[model samples]
Target: MVRVVVVDDEPMVCGFLRTILGSAADVEVVGEAYDGAAGVEAVRRSGPDVVLMDLRMPGMDGLTAIEHINRLPDPPHIVVLTTFDADQYVLRALRAGATGFLVKSTPPEELIGLVRTAARGHTVLSPSAARRLVAASTDSLSARDRAREVVASLTEREIQVLAGLGEGLSNARIAARLHLSEATVKGYVSRTLDKLGCVNRTQAGLIAHDAGIVEP
Candidate 1:
């Protein structure tokens, strides 16, 4: 089962997430919290496989919570809950160790799929979100040049795999698209992340966008 925690300031939002996630046979809402501090506690208490974290909250915000959770041993995958317009916060959250972000208005089935994707240690990025991130990034042309230079060092297959990640394709989907085994795709993903010195797949995906490997 994929255990999950929902952290939102509003009780109704938390309850709604609980209901939607609970309806899935393979998913369980293990805990809920109203703020960043409590959210961190909930994660520690439940040891869930995934966390749906709201970026804005009273007292402590989602970004701080994500950082705190990341410091925990064997941290769970954190997918920020946002309006999708908050590009800065979303990008900061990803940099602080969130696996990805989900627009609050995402379809129920798609939300479940994204949660499962994050649980499997894959990035849960949307093309639209990535585009916004790329546009909002303060990185100048020099940064883009650096990103491209770093990408050039990768093998052609690894670059393809990274582009798959830029498109938010999971390992299974990337494998099918490339006509390679899922295990091979997984290895390439690992090597690519290591080569880029990225903390997570989300960072690498963002780099792929900056590098123009997959247009944002």
Candidate 2:
């Protein structure tokens, strides 16, 4: 089973998420928290595989909670499921080690899928959230230039793999698109992440976007 913890300031939101996630036989909502401090505590207590977190709260806030949770030994994967998809929020969450950024407006089925994806150690982002990040990239010339420099250090094959990541394609999908073995694609992804100084696929994907490989 994929154990999960839901963290939102609204009790209704937490209950709603529990209901939605409960429908899946493979998923279990193990804990819920109404604020960031409690969210971190819940994570420590439950040791869940994934955490669905909200941004605005009475104290600590989602970004701070994410950083705190990330510092835990063998921390769970966190996905920010907030109503806000602002550029700064997205960047902050990801930079703090969130495995995904998703707005509450995401479809129920898609949200469930994203939770599962995070449990598997892959990056997730709502389509609209991704577009916002891409837009933010265009507004910052320095970020774009730095991204290009990073890309320049990569091989052509690694660049192709990164483009696939920016497009939100899984390893199997990227392999088929590039006509390479999935194992080969996985190696390329690891190398790309290393070259870009990224901790996860989401960061590499953002770099790909900033570099104009996936385009806005």
Best by TM-score: 2
Would you list the C-alpha lDDT of every candidate in the order shown? 0.88, 0.86
lDDT of model number 1: 0.88
Q: Write the per-residue lDDT of candidate 1 for residues 1-216, one digit (tens) a residue.
A: 999999999999999899998899999999999999999999999999999999989999999999999889999999999986557878878767788888899898888888999998877776777778877878647658988989988999999999998888888999999999999998999999999977688888888888888875
- Which portions of model 1 show Cα errors greater than 4 Å? 140-146, 149-153, 172-180
Candidate 2 root-mean-square deviation in Å: 2.3
The alpha-carbon lDDT assigned to residue 211 of candidate 1 equals: 88
Query: What's model 2's overall lDDT?
Result: 0.86
Please give the lDDT score at residue 46 for candidate 2. 96
- Backbone atom clashes (below 3 Å) for every candidate: 0, 0
Give the lDDT of residue 29 in candidate 1: 96
With candidate 2 superimposed using the best TM-score fit, by how many Å does residue 27's alpha carbon deviate from the native? Answer: 1.0
User: Candidate 2, 147: how far from true, in Å?
Assistant: 2.2
Candidate 2: stretches off by over 4 Å: 126-128, 137-139
lDDT of 2 at 18: 96
